[model samples]
Target: MKPAPFLLTALFSAAVSAAPATHMDTKAATEAVSVYYRNPNPDRALKIMQTIIADPLWKKDSARHNLSVWAAQILRQHPQATDKWCRAMKQYPAVTQDETAYFFFLANTSESRKCLRNLNISNHSKTYIAQNTPPDISSLSNISPADLDALWTTFYATGNPKAVEKVLDRVLDYAKAQKAQEKSNHKNIDMTGVAAAWSARSNIMQNQDIRKIFDTYLNRLNATDKALLQKILVQE
Candidate 1:
């Protein structure tokens, strides 16, 4: 009753793959931050950021922008450590222009503002920050398209049920807005909400919690959108 050779090989492979890496890559960091949003491991999360921020890939706007959001989200959980967060970011002087702009926009606290002031952020980014109002993640009523995009990205990054619920709330909000526009006799109603929900089909199909959300909200959608979603759910 010994294990077969192929089974032994598979077990060995699994054990090797399960071993933790010395440093977190971009995808791994993204996942770590996503989980940190819920679990709030300030020390390990900050260490992960310290590791990945040194990589040149993080200088790219896409990664930096997500980092800004993720960092801000993590900070929200640690209200008392705003100064600590600022100190950590100060170590990275090579932060890109896009990172400067996004981080500046989310830096509502005085300590955060001072941290950015001391950093090597470009004058143009400073001007942009000064001229425009910083986005308030706390206020969903005034959430811009960009912020909504970030929310959906967070849901995809973590697959957390809470993240799923946040996206569902936005989807329902968009549906409501679409209906409001239609009532005003607008010829071209924007179905951004429906489109957002449709875009989440693959993610929803893959997760049980997300699938339950899809089911709960299915009947809430208008006939056309609901039918379209039902068709895809069955076919896919």
Candidate 2:
């Protein structure tokens, strides 16, 4: 008479629910719920989520705001799932900014940038988040380099090159500032590292071929530097 996995998951979820909704507990709960959703049994995940939601504690706990976000993400990931969770996200405007950004990234298909734009995010913060995301390379494998470059350009521009150019200029300026700071703080800064950064900036400014620029930059690096850069770029 072993308990079912879903029952175990539900019990664990209930234990989490009983804890005081501290910021740390909220984060843990979000992650636990996400793991449960990614489980093969969608029904089980749905049941666990429903149990958590039905609990009177969550009904009044403002700290569990992020739980709704995780629920939306879980629902979106399921093939047969409805848009109910997405609608719920919209209803809860107090949802975390990161959660909102993640929702657009997950749910929107036309363009991740377009999704962000529709969120009415400020221009300054948009680039920061978008660049950090660096489109999933695997998903883009079928996408031609030219198409990717165009997509990236369009994303940065918000469909307007003139407006995006300013954003690019600011990005370059920030890079330069960072380079200067690194040189000043670390006297042994590698020259090749500096050159690669400049080359990347040049590529962006010229709207030149990004892949080619990356290749050229990589070729110019020393063996040690190349290895280091590869380690930084390539990840699971």
Candidate 3:
């Protein structure tokens, strides 16, 4: 078909624009990754980091803070992405140290702590690590469902549904055990927390075997609660 000159120019311009972006090479990718890293979307951050990290010829140290943060986010909804995130971190020295304390506490594995040991840590960060312990999750009170999403972020990073379910069991068991306490802290049962927590994992769980585990939690609610939760899950 005969094409308009503008259309041909547009396509050529598109190719040129893409050339710098794709055939663009490592130097440019590294710069782009560093600048917009502060942008909020972790998934995009991870992809950009991958682009920069993919270039073995590139030299400067990649920023640890953004890599850790975005890696954690990508692993949340996309549980299978653990290897990509983990491998990316492994390439950058002490980027592991850049991971937030919340993730350290959330996963609290020997491996997570091992990252701190290799790093030249500050006295303050050292003290924080030495004193670190699993959060007193059972005692959480006046905690809204939205707040619970923070906890979910930690578990999601693990990319293990069993881990998520275990946390649920602990919280539910404690809630069931402390009938008096539950009543006293009505705010603690904030259904919104469950919704928020689900929101993090919702995308990954959809149409997967692991999704059933998430659904099990949802099933605990009444029809109205379930409907409300579904809406929240699908919302932008």
Best by lDDT: 1
Q: Rank the candidates by lDDT, best first.
A: 1, 3, 2
Q: Candidate 3's residue-wise lDDT over 1-236, tens digit each?
A: 00111111122233335444445754454344323323435455556656644543222222332233324444444444444444545565543334333233333445544544554445666666567554433355544442244334333333445445544543444334344454575545545444434443443353253466658876887775555544544443
Q: Write the per-residue lDDT of candidate 2 for residues 1-236, one digit (tens) a residue.
A: 00111112223345566566554444354344524422445455445444554454344333233333333334344535433333333343433333345434533344433445545444545666656543332243233322223223332212223322333333333444554576485555444334433433443444434434445555766786555444433320
lDDT by residue for model 1 over 1-236, one digit each (tens)?
00111111122223235435643364465455534534556566667666556655455445556556656555555546666656666655544433543553564666566666666666667777778765554455543445555565455334445555555666656555655576576555444454455545645654555677677777677887675555544444
The alpha-carbon deviation from the true structure for residue 110 of candidate 3, after best TM-score superposition, in angstroms, is 4.5
Q: How many clashing pairs does model 3 include?
A: 2
Please tell me which model should have the higher TM-score, number 1 or number 2. 1
Please name the candidate that would achieve the greatest TM-score relative to the true structure.
1
Clashing pairs in 3: 145-192, 145-193
- Relative to the unseen true structure, what is the Cα RMSD of model 1? 11.6
Number of clashes in every candidate structure? 0, 0, 2
- Model 2 — which ten-residue stretch has the worst lDDT? 1-10
TM-score, candidate number 3 = 0.36
lDDT of 2: 0.39
Query: Predicted candidate 2: what Cα RMSD to the true structure?
Result: 16.1
Cα distance off (Å), candidate 2, residue 24? 14
Give the least accurate 10-residue stretch of model 1, judged by summed lDDT.
Answer: 1-10
